[model samples]
Structures are given as structure tokens and as C-alpha cells.
Target: MKKLIKYGNENSQYGELYLHDTNCIGTVCLFHGGFWTMPHDLHQFDNVAHELLNLGFCVWNIEYRRIGETNHKWRDVFDDATKAINELNNIKNIYNHVNINNVFVVGHSAGGHLAIWLNSQDLKIDVKKFIGLSPILDLEIAYYKNAGDGSVEKLLHGNPNEFPERYLFGSPIKLKRKNSSELIIHGNMDDYVPIKWSKLYHEKIRKFTDISHLIELEACGHMDFIDSKSNVFDVLKSNIR
Candidate 1:
């Protein structure tokens, strides 16, 4: 069964929870990507959430305030992501069968950035794994590359020189290496976020931890990671365990 659970009072501060029947292997938290804009939402991951539920993992597909929304802030997007993950504790209280301890966070595109960023936070519960599916690892690079057509500048309210601290806080590349196992899967053909950022991030993270891994898919694109019929989805299923 699926339930809409609120993590905060705001309209966007809620997630769709997909529960397992009896026993669950763990919890898989999903964040969808839309360049922090209002055009895309959690509905993009609905198919994948159901697929994960069929695999015996409880799923939390989160929604947070994005640009173009009324009174939206960039920092609050990060805050909402944190609160949504932390809400898993309260979820555990109601659904004891859901394993919060063995949680895996999966994100695509900008959502990948949020997932890895959430891993960097000092949260109440530890994340077992952080998976980025063609995520934006470096905001500075994304800004220069003009990824999302100036979305980075719009998100931080300035360039890297102007708001260095905001970039430091938002970019996974600028954050400390997370203790949790990290996996990044990017397609060589991805024109959206590009595979370069993922490769760069993997090299940076490898200096600190041996558990981090990056996979470059041959003919895949940015949207393949979210597609249920794509091979990237199969790769995602294999690694979540």
C-alpha cells in the first residue's frame, strides 16, 4: 500500500510511502530530479517505487519545494530532503517491519545531488548506501557548463565567486566524504548532467574511501536511469542489495 506522509507543514514537504506486505529487506528512499524546478515532481519515480516494493523494500519517494513555487528557497530544498529521510524514524514506529537502519537513498539528475548531499549531513540515522544516478556532483562545474540552462546560478542566486559558501554547501564535490558506501552510475551519452561530473566526483571521493564506485554506461542517456525498462534500472536493482 502507498500512503502520502508529510514531513513538514509545507505543501511540498511530503513523500509517498510504499510498504511491503510482511517482511522488508530495507528501505529505499527516492528523490526525483528536475534541476530544482517546479516542472518535475515525485511522480517520475512512481513506477520505480512500485518496482522496489515488489522487491521487498519499503520506498519513500520524497517531494520538496522547488523553484517557480511560491516562496521557495534553495536551502529549504536541502532541508526538506533531510527531514524526509529523518522521517523514516517515525515511519519505523508505525511500520515496525520497515528497516530504517538498512536504508538506501537513490536519486537521479539533480535528485542525485540531493541524495549525496543528504549523505554528507549529520543526520539522526545513518544511511547504509548513497546512490547517484547521473547526479550533479559539482555545482561550480554545472554553472560553467550551463547545465539546465543556468539553473545553478538561479539556484544559488549567484556565481561561484559571489556565493562560494552556497556552492560549498550545495555541491557534493565540495562536501566531505560520506562514511556510507557510495555508488554513481552515469551514461556516457548523457547530455543533461554529463558523465564528466560523476567521474570527477568519483576520483575526489576515492581519495578518502575505497567503497565508492562509478559505472559509465555505454549507450544510455540521462532519462534511462529513471526508466523502468532501461538497463540502468536493472543495474540499480542489483546494487541496492
Candidate 2:
């Protein structure tokens, strides 16, 4: 069973905590993707969370502020991401059964962008690994390619030339790489987020750390990687190390 914990008063500022009964491996902070919009929520990763629980890992399926919400801004979404991770200790203290160790951050699509971005932050948490599923790695490329149906423009509120600071700070590719091992899984047939972005990100980041890997799933699309029923899930399990 999962428990709901609120980090902020807003409707979007909470996470579902799933705890395993035995052999608690560690904590997995899971974030979903909807191009940083409200059309999608944390429910998208319920299956993945359950799988993680079965793997003996506690899951924190986080829901952060989205662009479509009232008075929402990209900055709020970023702030909420940090807030959610910072709240992990509180959750452990409140629920005596909750034990968090060897943290792993995982996100899909735009959430993948958030995962890597959060890793770059000097947070108190010690994340063992970072994983991106069909993630939007490069914001500049995303802006140029006009990925996510102009969602990137809508996210930063303008073009790279208009708001260069936002791109420089918000984009994972632009941030300095962390020492933790990172895994990127993208589908070859993905139309929503180009696989080339993943490849480019991998090529650049691999120079800094040899532990990073990019796995391209054949005949899979953007959504297939998150679907537990898909064969891509098996690949995800094998490569999570």
C-alpha cells in the first residue's frame, strides 16, 4: 500500500510513498512526464513504482507543479522538485517503518530532465544512480527542434535567445555532470522526444564518466518505455545497475 505525503499546501505538491515489507533495498524517487504540463500526473508511474517496490525498493512517486496549473511557472516546478526530495527525511521520521538508503532518482521524459537537473543540485541526498526514460536531455535542441509541440517554448516562456539564462540553468545537458552512475533508456521509434538528443547527450557526458550508458530500444516508442507490460521494462530491469 502507498501513503500520501504533502510537502506543500498546493494540490501538486505531494508524493505517494510505497514501502516494501522486507529487504528494503533503498529509495527510488520517481517522476512522471507530461512535457511539464498538467495533462499528465504522477499516476503514470504507479506500475513502475509497484515494480520498484517488488524489487525491494521504497518508491517516492512525486507530483510537482505543472505549467497548466493556476499561477504556475517553470521556476515553481523546479522549486517543487527540490522540495519533494528534501522532504524525504521528514517522511522517514514520521513513518518509523520507512527506511531510506542508497537513493536512486528516476524520471520519464520531462521528468527525466528533472531527475538529471536535480542530480546536479548540491542537495543533501546521496543518490547512487540516476535514470532517464525517453528523457528530453537538451533544452536548446528541444527549443530548436520544437519538440513537445512547442511545449519547450511554453515551458521557458520564450526562445533560447530570449531567455538564455533559463536554458543554461534548466537544461540537464547544460549542467555539470554528477559523479553518480547515470542510465538513459530511449526508444528508437520515439517521435515525441528524438533519440538523437539522447545520443548527443550520451556522447558528450560519456567523456566525463565511463559509468554512464545509453540504451536504445528497437521498435519502441516514447510511451512504451514506461509501460510495464512492454518488453522495454525487461530491458530497464537489466540495465538499472
Candidate 3:
């Protein structure tokens, strides 16, 4: 295992990444949930990686520039995610154990939103499936619902009014994939992100694809997915295989 940090253009360095043997079943690029803020990354998913490694699977826990980590951080959350995926592919070439045809991503909350968006993205990596735990995939709803602010949203799509194209292009919800490789887990009683956010994304996704599945945790809250308050880990582990 090795902990590596990749530097960015602005003297920012992506945080510690845990890379185990590359010759496992598949490479899972994990993104931790932090709502584009700082103090969040792959460290929170240490237990998940532990469970994954115990199951004889190769895993890569990724961390990148978050809101608090850099001075110019904003919409770079998505950029970091796509960059991590690309980086995973580069090292994967030598190992030859990574399932090139079936790479997986798992994320929580904001990370969940990122994981699903990665699967839907038009990037170079070939994503087999994505496990999203309480994902914030629908940006349009978050905008009108005041869940996300101007500065936070602007970092991604820029000014929504001044650049409608930017909004339309940067939003994964506004885009479509030939097929959805997604497994979404959202709490039915989530007060933070609201269940409707996942609902709206699911509804929009079904129009274009057929492989989206959502697991609604009854009587659960937003943070419960990664918290001990709920048995979300069991659910997440069961789906990992």
C-alpha cells in the first residue's frame, strides 16, 4: 500500500490516497462526501476500504482539493473527481489486474452525487457501476430550493444567468447517458438534501437509461447513511459485490 499526493496547477495538493494492490477484482475510486466544503475526503471511508480489502478486492480511496483546502477552491469538486478517475487509469495499465471494462465508484452525500455523475460523465474512463449514498445529483432543485449558494454553484457552472450554457453543460442532471450504471441510496426522511433531489434525478435518469436503482432508507436522515445511526454500511457492502 502507498499513500500518494498529486499536485495541482495552483500549488494545491490532493490529499492522501490509499492505493493497495492493483491486481484485484476491480478498482473502486471512492469520493468522500463534504458538499464542496473543506475537511472532507477519503479518510472518512477508511472503514469501507478496510471492508473492501478484507473481501479480497483492490481499492483506491481518493482525496482531492476541497473548499477549505485551497484558496481558489469552488466548483473544482467535479474537476478533482474526473482527474482522480484519469489518474487511476494511468497506474492501472501496469498492474493489468484492474478490470478495465468494469471500474466502480462509491461516494457518500456530495461524494455520492459525484460518483453517479462520474458514471454519467462523458469521460475517458469506462465506468461499470456507481454506488451513491445520499447523492446530491440534482443541481437545478438545489438552486431553486436554496440548498446551494451562488459562490458554491458558480465554481462549477459559473453564473447561472450570465452563462446558461455553462449551467446546462456542467450539470450532470441536465445530461444523459446511454445507460445508467448507478446504485443510489437515499434516506426517505432526509432533511438536509431532501429525498426529492434523488427522486428528481431518478425520474430524469429513467427517461434515458434502465439500470438505475434507488434504496430508500425508511425513517432515516441524511447523515445516517455514513453514520452508525443506521445500518447503511451493511447495505453498502452487500451491493459492492
Candidate 4:
């Protein structure tokens, strides 16, 4: 069982913190998936939270409002993640035995996209490392595919033409930050997000910053990166240290 604590708006689709302490050295904050989404299903959070706990990492898995999650935007979700991490950092004593410096942020699918988006932001409080497991980092690609009839476009509030700059910001492949927050992980070979997003993001950012690294995985698909029993766990574990 996980201890639940509510922060931010209890009634609003925003500002609720699902705090889980694994009593470990690293403190990881995980966001859920569904196209940079929220009001998300909590099922995927369990295994990774539990695995990180058993591995001795204090995990503060977060829950925030997503696209269909109340009145939120991609930028707002990014801010929400930032504030949540700062909130946790402020009250680290409550988390217990958690290393403050080893703090990390991770996401799967859309959540993975959010993790990278937030990490790539020009914020004052920097996340130590980011693990975007098969994140939809390139909104433009999804928009072009019109897959799910432009489901990715709809999440960004419709039509990349309506929000050209927003697409640029959300896209790790497009934006070139002089320095990036640490990113390391692999995308599932079968996943639709494609390795190109992570790949291009690495290629461009690596020119200016050495903090980012992306690994492409074989025989793995999308959510498999977070599953402890999956082969990705070995790859993720290998580099996390």
C-alpha cells in the first residue's frame, strides 16, 4: 500500500501529489502517460514505483491534470511538474533517507515526453537527470502522421498551425538548448514515437551539451522500459548509476 497526501487543489484537476517513499537514496518523481496526458490511469505507476522502492530509491510519483485532465495545457503541465519537484525538495525531511542530490524525473510515453520537455526548460531549479522512455518528443511528426486522426494535435489543443511555437517548445528534436538536463534511456523498437525524436534531440543538443544520452532498445516496445521484469530494466539500471 502507498501513503497518500494531497497538495495543491484537492478539487481541481491540478496540484495533487501522490507521494511514495521507497526509503532509498535516490528520489524519483514519475509522471503518467497518455499523450503528455493526465487524469491518467494509475496502473502503470505501480510496478516502477515498487521496483524503485525495493531498489532503495525514495520515489515521489506525481499525479497532475493532463489534456483531458481539467483545463490544462502542455506548458501548464510542464510548470506543474516543476512546482511539484520543488515542493518535494522543500520538504525532503518528510520523505526519509532520500538523497537530495540524486533526484531524478522519469516518464513513459506522453509522460516521458513531459519529463524531457520539463527538463529541457530554462528553469531555475534543475532536475538532475531525465529518463524519457519512448516519449513522443516530436509533436510535429505525430501531427503529420495524423495517426489516431491527429490525436497528438488535439492534445495540444488542435492544429499545429494554431500553435506553431508551442510545437517547437514541446519538440526536443526542434529546440536547441545550449545546455540540457541529463537525459538517458532507450525507446522501444516497436513503439510509434520513433527513436528519431530522441535521436535528433541528442544529436543537436550533444553539440552544445554532453548531459543527454538516448539508447535505442531492441525487442522492446513503448511501456516496456519501465517494467522491471523487462530487458530494458537491465539497460536502464546499467546507466542510472
Give the top-scoring candidate (lDDT): 1
Model 2, 161-231: lDDT tens digits are: 99999999898887888777888999999989989889999999888778678888899898986788789
What are the per-residue Cα lDDT tens digits for candidate 4 across 100-145?
6777778777777777777656554455777787776778887897
Q: Each prediction's Cα lDDT score?
A: 0.89, 0.85, 0.69, 0.66
At residue 81, give the lDDT of candidate 3.
80
CA deviation > 4 Å runs, candidate 3:
5-22, 68-75, 94-101, 148-151, 157-159, 178-180, 227-230
Model 1, span 88-194: residue lDDT tens: 99988988888887899999999999988887898877898999999999999999999998989888878999989999999888888768888899999998987
Deviation (Å) of 13 in candidate 1: 0.1
Cα lDDT for residue 17, candidate 2: 94
Q: How well does candidate 4 score on lDDT at residue 9? A: 66
Q: How are the candidates ranked when ordered by lDDT, highest leading?
A: 1, 2, 3, 4
| Per-candidate TM-score against the hidden true structure | 0.97, 0.94, 0.84, 0.83
Best by TM-score: 1
Error of 2 at 129 (Å): 0.5
- Candidate 2 lDDT at 6 equals 97
lDDT of 1: 0.89
lDDT (0-100) at residue 79 of candidate 1? 90
Error of 4 at 180 (Å): 5.6
